[model samples]
Target: MDASTFFILVLIGSAAACLLGSLTGLGGGAVLTPLLVLVLGVDLRYAIGASLIAVIATSSGATATFAREGFTNIRVGVVLEVATVAGALLGAYIAGLVDKSTIAIVFSIALFWSAWATLRGAPPVVPTGESDALATRLRLASSHPTHGGSQPYGVVRVPSGLALMFGAGVLSALAGIGSGVIKVLAMDRVMRLPFKVSTTTSNFMIGVTAAASVGVYLHRGQIEPRICAPVVLGGLVGSMVGARLLPRLRTRWLRVIFAIVVIGAGVEMCRKAIVGGF
Candidate 1:
């Protein structure tokens, strides 16, 4: 394809990816990387670099709105980011050593996991009405706006949540996705934060996590501005639109549809890994 045609197609595909990602709280990198690799025949490393850029863009755009609405808990997000940043740097180093097929296989596995989580739906947040000592020390406890007005929530299992955030960062760098699936799991399941807080806080941290590895990718010359430009632009626009539509839509239905798509993407990635050996 010519340069212009390739850019246009990438823009369109990235937009769709971001829209679905935002709606499902998954983030665009999950879909964008696969689309570039399987369809556009891009190198895996380059695709990852571009996807990270889109992740940062989508996260920044969506987080601004979510934060303003009081969905994001800034304190919790900041504390978790310390772990994620360290993990992201390590994951980026590992990515450079791994073969393309190995990355593809890992990416496929992550996709499957993400799909399963989406299908299962966000677990109910059962606040123990008691907070972890660590959480209290960090002041991670917070509240978010609900239909009933501001609802308070307590943070629990800070140590476990931080450990999971580390894993989420590793996955984010390894697969070139936001790894919001794992982030939400850590917050909602382990920390006992409300679902909305978990999702928004995940979004709040994604950009920083991706940014941590982005510098490494850039230094390695993986980021191609030509590809990244359209991906970022489209992702930002699409995610903003998706954020606006989030409150109106039934998330369960969106999750079902998005999960099906994620499963298909996973199958494709695995097929590629099998057919094209390391």
Candidate 2:
């Protein structure tokens, strides 16, 4: 494709990915990377770099709304970010040594896993009754606004959650996706936070996680301004629109549709890897 055509397509594709991501609470990077590599014929590294930029843009944009709505648990996000940032730096270094095909295969596996998890639906948020002493001391336990008022929730298994967040960060740097799936799983399931709180907190942390590796990608010259500029702008705009529309949309249907898309992307990535096209 010509430069102008490629730019337009990237803009549109990134916007669509961000819209779907915002609606599904998945973040734009998950969809954007595969779309760029598989459909647009972009190099995996460049695609990942652009997707990371889009992830930071979309996450930062949505985080403002979530925070204002009292859905984000800032304290929890901040505490977990220490682990994530550390892991992200390490993962970025590892990415430099890993083969593109290996990265593609791992990314595809992660996509499939995410699809399966999403398809299974978000498990009911069950409070563990027991709270982490560290969480209590850090005041990570918090409340989020509900229709009636606000409901309080406790944080559990803090160490486990922190470990998982580290893994999430590793995946984020390696695949150039937000790895929100892992973040939400850690907070919502392992830590036993409210669903809304977990999702928003995951969104809150994603930008920082991406930013950590983004510097590495930039230094490596993988982040191209020509590609990242439109992707980031389009992703931000689309995520804003999606966030506005989220309350009115049927999220169950959105999850189903997006799950199919994720599965398709995973299959395509695997095919490319097998064909030596990674």
Candidate 3:
């Protein structure tokens, strides 16, 4: 395809992917990576590099909106970022050693797990009016604006959450995605934060995680400016729009969209892996 046609397709694809990504906290990389490799016939490593750019852009575009609306937990995001960043560096280092098909398989598995976790649905959490001592000491407890007014929430299982974040970062580097699904699982399921708070916080954290891995990709000569530029531009636009739509969406709808998008991408990756794309 010609340069202009490739750019247009990438722009459209990244925009759609980021729209759902910003809403579900998956980040655009999950979908965009597969689209680039499978549909656009880009090399896997190059797709990963471009996807990282999109993930960073999506985070930057959506995070400010979420923070302004009081959905993001900055305290939580900052704390977990330490582990994620560390893991991202390690994962990026390992990515150079692994073959492309292996990366594809691992990426698909992670996506399926993310889909199952969100689709299974968790019970509604009612605030117990008590906060964990560790969380309280760390000032992790916070509130978000709800239809009824401000609703307060508490944090729990800090150690477990941090461990999961580290894993999330590693997978993110391997998959060339933001690892937002695992981040959301850590905060929403393990940390016991509200769903919206978890998603927004995941958005805030993924950008930093992606940035860490991006350096490794850069040194390896995987990042193509031509591919990354349009993808980032489109992702920024889509993420901003998705961020605006999140406040009005119900939790159930978000979960449904998250599961659907993740599963579709996972299936596509699996197909490419079986076909030996590398």
Candidate 4:
């Protein structure tokens, strides 16, 4: 397509991603990546680079609201950032030596894995939950304001959570995705944090986690200025609006539909990978 049309697409797409991120705490990665490559005819490598930049922009835009409203736990985010970012750097470095198709195939599998995990519908809440000694000592857990009474949640397997975060970072950097899906899964399942806390905390850490990848993408000349400028600007604005509208739209149906979208996108990506479209 023409330059103007491509720029317009990036703006609109990024705005949508911001909305998704604001509403469900994810955006620009799963949805935008394929669209850029398939519809816009951009190279997958370039699409991934730009999408990773968009993830950083999206998270940076949302961090303030999440923190101000007490939705994000800063200490936990900071602690996890160390592992994730380090992993991202290593993944980015490794990817440079690998074929883009290989990276694409791996990315697609990761997406499917995340979608299936999310589809399990957040397993039953733990009863009489207990935290491991490390979780208790670090105070890495807290209670959130639920519909009825504010219920408390605890985290366990602190070391496991960090290990997963490291793995998530590697995947994200390799794929130019936000890696929030894996991050949340680690905290919610292994760490045993509540859904809200795990999601918000994952959101809190994404920007920091992406920094390592962002630098690598830039240095590798994968990011196009024409794409990044409009997408970033538009995403920043869209995320602000999404954050404001999220509370009002918190309904069961909305969440269910969102999950379906994730699953569909995830499966499509996996199909492409298997077919050697990577």
**TM-score of every candidate:** 0.96, 0.96, 0.90, 0.87
Candidate no. 1 TM-score: 0.96
Candidate 2 residues 61-170, lDDT tens each?
A: 77666667888888998999999999899889999999999999888888887888777877877765456788889888877777888777888889999999999999
> Model 1 Cα displacement at 143 (Å)?
2.2
Each prediction's Cα lDDT score? 0.88, 0.88, 0.85, 0.77
Clashes of each: 0, 0, 0, 0
Per-residue error for 22 in candidate 3, Å, reads: 2.2
Off by over 4 Å in 3: 121-123, 248-264
| Candidate 4 deviant stretches above 4 angstroms | 127-129, 146-152, 250-278
lDDT over C-alpha atoms for residue 186 of model 2 = 95
Instruction: Name the weakest run of 10 consecutive residues (lDDT summed) in model 3.
Output: 121-130
Residue-level lDDT for 274 in candidate 2: 86
Clashing pairs in 4: none
Of candidate 4, the 10-residue stretch with the lowest lDDT total is: 119-128
lDDT of 4: 0.77
Q: What would the per-residue lDDT of candidate 1 be over residues 146-171, giving only the tens digit for each residue?
A: 77987888898998999999998998
